[model samples]
Target chain A: MKGFKYLRNVTTLKMDSGKCINCSKCIEVCPHHVFALNGDKVTIINLDSCMECGACAKNCPAAALHVDSGVGCAAGLITEWLRDHRLLAKVECC
Target chain B: MPRISADLTFADRLGSWRVRWGIGRMNYIVPPGLYAVGRPNSDSPVLVTANYKKSYDSVRSVLAERDCWILVLETYGINVWCAAGKGTFGTEELIRRIGASELTKVVSHRQLVLPVLGAAGVAAHKVKKETGFNIRYAAIRAKDIPQYLDSGMRTAPAMREITFTTWERVVLIPMEFVEALKPTAIAAALLFFITAMLQDRNAGFLAVCGYVGAVAAGAAGTPLLLPWLPGRSFAFKGVLTGSIWSIIFYMLAGGSGWSRFMALAAFMILPAVSAFYALNFTGCTPFTSRSGVKKEMKVALPAMACALLAGIAIAITGMAI
Candidate 1:
């Protein structure tokens, strides 16, 4: 992770302050430390660092957050899409 | 608590069987619509997700104790980032789902919580314009959903980092080894045959060992030593390890009388092969970007090719003379 820097900003995460209960559930689930607490509310201080794993939205009780989290690897996605289209033989890499 | 349907069990069984047999992991497509989980109240928070079964299940399974509404969108059985890349998981889908589900009729609140990875697919501003529900991008993993809700929807820094731990690295080795085995076996067999024909039977066995060892060093050892390897690039790291292996093989296999040319050939070729296979690992790792992989391949490929060719040339000359 130190030497490798990702080119794709593949995270679909965004937060609405109006609905945020400031429960900080996003902080606990995320492996990347993408979010930080700003007083009683949550902040996406490092939005670009997200890998879109979808741990936060599923855990939020307030239902005040949204993200299109999923696998971010290009090769994995291409293989998945190809299988969906029936162009390539079925292969599960994950 | 709302009971999980029998259909879910059937689906889980099928998913696991498929995975075991190396079949494509089936993603169940949920229609882009809102549905209640555990008989939630109208005021319950709305959680958003792609229609991929794995993503849906991960969210639902984690939310078993809570009551909420799940807004699933058609991602064509693909996960969020990939679906987003293809535009299948986008603002348009979210808006359509919101309208079709009559979400306004179900919930009084205007906010929709979404997975962070879906940002590449869904445009928050467009979703707001087309549908009144404001998008809130949440944490990256499903396990943290409960904590997120309790924290008033706040995210901490730990929730965002992506880790590739030793166990994670170890789990990936099986598939890589399986994939590489066919080619490695073929290469080893060919080397064995050639060496046996040109030299002695013992030489043939040693050659086979060298080839197999190089493959292991490159494909398996390199990945396992990823964090500790000296060089930043995978290829360099692999070559470093392979060279050490080559030296060990040389001392054990009686290369002392060997000419400088042959010894040079051994050093050059074995490590290059190892490095090439190790460099291929960029596709497997989480940290590598497409651009970075391309950059590494551009420089590493030609050098590997040259070294391999030079080694072959030296070996042939040594045998001829």
Candidate 2:
């Protein structure tokens, strides 16, 4: 995560500060240290560092965090696209 | 109250090796339930993990000296990180496992130490509400579990961090190489036959070997030299290495009499295939994201296809000439 910086602003990770309980679950669970406790609120300290693994969103007690997370495999995406277009009857492979 | 041993036998190492080589991958699973690691007692800490044998073995091997209960959730043989991503290692499974194993009856403490990576699937609050057990997200790696437990059940900052060292990258190469075998073989055979039809058998054999080299450079070499590679995008780094390999291959394989079209084709095809394979390796990496891979595919896929097609067309034209 230190040397690698992928595309910017591509992650769907968002936090609802209004619903945040300041549990710091996001801060604790994030592998990339993307979240930080700011006073009484949790803030996205480094959005770019988020790989969207959905740990924060899944563990959030108050349902304050959201992200569309999945495997980042190109072959998986191609198969999904093929399935969507009805080009492949059944697609498998991760 | 099923007692399980913590010492890893030779059989365990062999089994893990077989799985790493892509053998018995689907069936490489341990039964999902509670097991005692190192003569654990009710007062000992409980650690939640996946049912994958590799994951189980890794966790238990590290706790050889510590007395602990391992609560393995059914993940259908998938590793904790991937299974958690798929939600198989989620709250429902944890609750189900806890209830089935009668964990409360066996363990005095209500705290379950979960791998930090598994935080993706589990919610501490929901599990607490459902099972009355608090989920404590622990070390990212099982090797740190001893220290974590020793330090008053607290994970040090180093324990929480994930670092992909050269050895970490190297260990993944065997599986990557195994996965590439079929495709590389097929491509090599196809290239051999096609080039034999166009030129001579000697030319075909050399071309096939060259192509295999390119594929290996992409699939294995790129990952081994990841940090030092030139570009941020894996595709670019692959192509860079690929181009260098292609040129060296051409010179070594006696390209003096090769038509300009053949040279062009070699340059284009080798790098294109290498880039494609390298780009696919993004999925295997620790840091790559779905969004980043999607962005890369959107741009690189079409380009790879075009380059490959053009290279083939030029190769045929050169042969005809």
Candidate 3:
């Protein structure tokens, strides 16, 4: 997190500002520090740092945060795609 | 809460080592229930954690001198972070564990200090509303627990933060290597047998070495030199390493006698194989996201397949000539 950064603008993380109650649960839970309290509402400050771990979204009481959270690794995604397309022998995601 | 010893014996250390090495890791679990960290009573603060032995050990070892209650949820030996993502360490499990343990009758406080990383599954408000135990995410690391409790249960920014230091990255490598062992062996054996039939025994041996080198460069080397590698996409960095390995092999293995086509094939195939393995290593990492991995595979996987196929074709043609 300090010295390394992943790809930019690829995360599907979104925040519903209107639904935010500024409880700061998202801020407290996020390991990446993706959220910030902007007055009475929470905002995605470090949007690119989001790893889509779903911590913030899951803990959000107001349901203001959303992200397509899963095993964000190439092997898992490849296995899923291949299975869906029937391209390879059924292999489980590790 | 039942009083239990917090001391980690030699056997626990050996067991943890075995688990880290992927031996009996899946079944290496502790019974999920409320246990004492030190001499804890009903007044002691409660800490929630997964039932993975490693996770339980990590929590208890940090609270050696302190008295606390640890609520371990049944996560089927998975660590807190992954188990949280899988929902085994979710709201339902927490609530069920609290109820099953009769935690309300044991503890006077309504708060349950959960690991910050576990927030992905447990909804604090829902847990509070349903079970009357207000979930408080204490800190990202268990080592910071004492300070967190001393600071009146308030988590400082640094405590909540996550950092993937070099040492942290290095520690995760062993499991990755262990997981990849079977696949690597099978691939190497296949390469050896196929190349022996296609060429000579010495050629088969050389081909096997080349393939193993590629795997090491991608699965092992790439992670060690991750920060310094030149590309955001792991596949690209792996390709660079693979190309370097191929060139080194060419010099060491005497590729000068081969046709230009054969040398080209070696460089292409080695790098592509390395790149594919490196890309797969994304699953072992902390930062790579679903969308990013998908985008990378879309471009890299096809390129790897094409390079591998073309390299084989060129190698065959050069041999015929």
C-alpha RMSD values across all candidates = 7.9, 1.4, 1.7
Per-candidate Cα lDDT values, in order, are 0.71, 0.87, 0.87
Models 1 onward score TM values of 0.68, 0.97, 0.96
- Model 3 spans with C-alpha error above 4 angstroms: A86-91
Reference-based lDDT, residue A55, model 1 = 51
Off by over 4 Å in 1: A1-94, B1-21, B26-36, B51-53, B99-102, B181-209, B244-263
Per-prediction DockQ scores?
0.14, 0.73, 0.80
Q: Would you list the clashing residue pairs of candidate 3?
A: none
> For this target, which candidate reaches the highest TM-score against the unseen true structure?
2
- What tens-digit string does per-residue lDDT give for candidate 3 at B74-189? 99899998898889999999999989999999888798999998998899999999998888999989999989999999889999878777787777777877877899899889
lDDT of 1 by residue, B1-321 (tens): 223431357767677445433356444555566767776777899988877777777788778668888888888787765676566777788888888888898889898887765655666656776777877776667777888888998765545455677776776666667667889889888888887888778777877888788887887888788888875567787798789789988998888977777788889989998897787776667555444444466677789889999998988788778
- Candidate 1 total steric clashes: 51
C-alpha lDDT of residue A41 in model 1: 66
TM-score of 2: 0.97
Deviation in Å, model 1, residue B259 alpha carbon: 7.1
Model 1 RMSD in Å is 7.9
